[model samples]
Target: MTSFPQIDAVYETHLPVRDLDRAVEFYHDTLGLELAYRQEARGMAFFWIGGQQTGMLGLWQAGSAPMRMVLHMAFRLGQEAVLAVPAELKAKGAEPLGFEGEPVREPVVIGWMPALTVYCKDPDGHSIEFLCPLPDAPDPDFGIGPWSRWLQR
Candidate 1:
């Protein structure tokens, strides 16, 4: 039998957006992602998730909102960077949201993975997340709650 190929990480993910230019501005300008390339003829734009070669996010011009699907994607960052993302997003006029999609002042911790995370929505309504793994041990009993509550554990 042939050995199974080892899948490392997500190389890329594609998203359909109503407007390519607006999506580019949100990913490249507001979120500060590195624009990898643009194919005007293809009606698409690509951004580097971490760096030039690490991971890629592609945004395709899908015409209308009704035709596009709302999706969610997470960007991994350092502990400090993840903590600061909410404030920076807010300053850019984006709302930092919690698991329930309510505005939150701090990041949240998913007790099972115990990862710190915060969310925001793109102009096209796709949910974008900033996340970091916690150094602490997992506590399933905690369920999911704010970062402060996680710290108290």
Candidate 2:
């Protein structure tokens, strides 16, 4: 077998959007990802995720009559910030979601991964997640549940 370089981390991902400008505003102004570069001729915009060298996210314009798709991507954050996402997103008129994709009052802990996470949707309905791995041991038996419950365990 040919030896390939072991994978490290995801450097970038792209999402199709109905409007590049609106998506750029949501990702830059709302989500606070730093604007990296933009190509107006191609109707594309790129943003630095985490930091300039760590990760990048590309937003591409889906022209008229484009077929729709729902994609998922996550951003890692510190524990405290993950806990605050529900309220912060709500304040910005975005709905925070639990694992089941329903409106949530707080972040949920997916016990198998033991990660605290919350989800929101972009204007194009792509799933966006903010998460932080927990210090606790993995508890696959616990499945997924409220963040508060995880703390009491």
Candidate 3:
């Protein structure tokens, strides 16, 4: 049997956007991602996800048709920062959503992943998640709740 080489982690992801400039504004201005560079002729832009040269996300302009599938992208953040996402997004005129697409009043804990997560949509309707794993999270089981409530338990 042939063994496949071990893969480390995702290096990058490309997303389709209707307008490259708008996508750049949201990612670079609103989401606070650093603008790596842009290719005007190609109608594409790249943003640094974590740090300069650490991770990359490419946004390619999709002329007319909408994205075939709404993509979900999760970013890992410090615990406190993850907890602050809802308010932060709201302050920037964006609505924070839960996994069910409902307004997120507080961070939700996914017991299986044991991570505290908050969701929101980009200008192009792509789902984005900010998450941080809970220290000593309980064994995987279905769990979701407001951060205050989850922490109490």
Candidate 4:
């Protein structure tokens, strides 16, 4: 028998931002994500985005302008939680930076995951998604399964 591999590592995500305090307030208040820790180092502020041990978000505050929108990070909202995402975004005064259909364009009922899914950008233009369980699908797959399966080529 083989032993299942466990991820014994801390996840760190670095995001460049224009304002650290505003970002902190938005992440904590609007998204309901709690702050774990913060650093006032020379040009950055590392914030833990969830509970004390969930993960950390690194904010690089060395620039006057907000970072570009070339890339983004996402989070899973489970099946039931996906349903409330749009309303939550609206309440937060956010407009979708992506399209209005398909994988990242719009929220749709995906046959692959059997859930209602929607993708959007955060205050710093990071892409995030929310998904609700499928109407008749069994179980759930949180991630894309494998890197190769996600490649377009």
- Please give the range of 10 consecutive residues that has the lowest summed lDDT in model 3: 136-145
Ten contiguous residues minimizing lDDT sum, candidate 2: 61-70
Candidate 4 residue lDDT tens string, 1-153? 998999765477777776777777767777777566677666565656455577777766646544454456656556556656666766786653323422332355544555566676656656655555555543244333221222221
How many residue pairs clash (N, CA or C atoms closer than 3 angstroms) in each of the candidate models, in the order given?
0, 0, 0, 6
How much is 16 displaced in model 4, in angstroms? 1.2
What C-alpha lDDT does candidate 3 achieve relative to the native structure? 0.84
- lDDT tens readout by residue for model 1, 1-153: 999999977889989998899889999878998888999999999888878668999999987844657999988899999899889999998999998898999999999888999999999999998989888888899998999988877
Best first by lDDT, ranked: 2, 1, 3, 4
Off by over 4 Å in 4: 1-10, 41-43, 64-69, 96-106, 131-153
Q: Which candidate is the best by lDDT?
A: 2
RMSD per prediction, one decimal? 1.4, 1.4, 1.8, 7.7
Clashing pairs in 1: none
**Model 3 C-alpha lDDT per residue in residues 41-113, reported as the tens digit of each score:** 9999988888765689999998665336678888889899988899999998889988788898788888766
Off by over 4 Å in 2: 64-66
Model 1 sits at a Cα RMSD from the real structure of 1.4
Q: Which pairs clash inside model 4? A: 79-132, 79-133, 99-105, 101-105, 101-106, 114-134
The all-Cα superposition gives candidate 2 an RMSD in Å to the true structure of 1.4
User: Which pairs in model 3 have colliding backbones?
Assistant: none
Give the per-residue Cα lDDT of candidate 1 at 121: 97
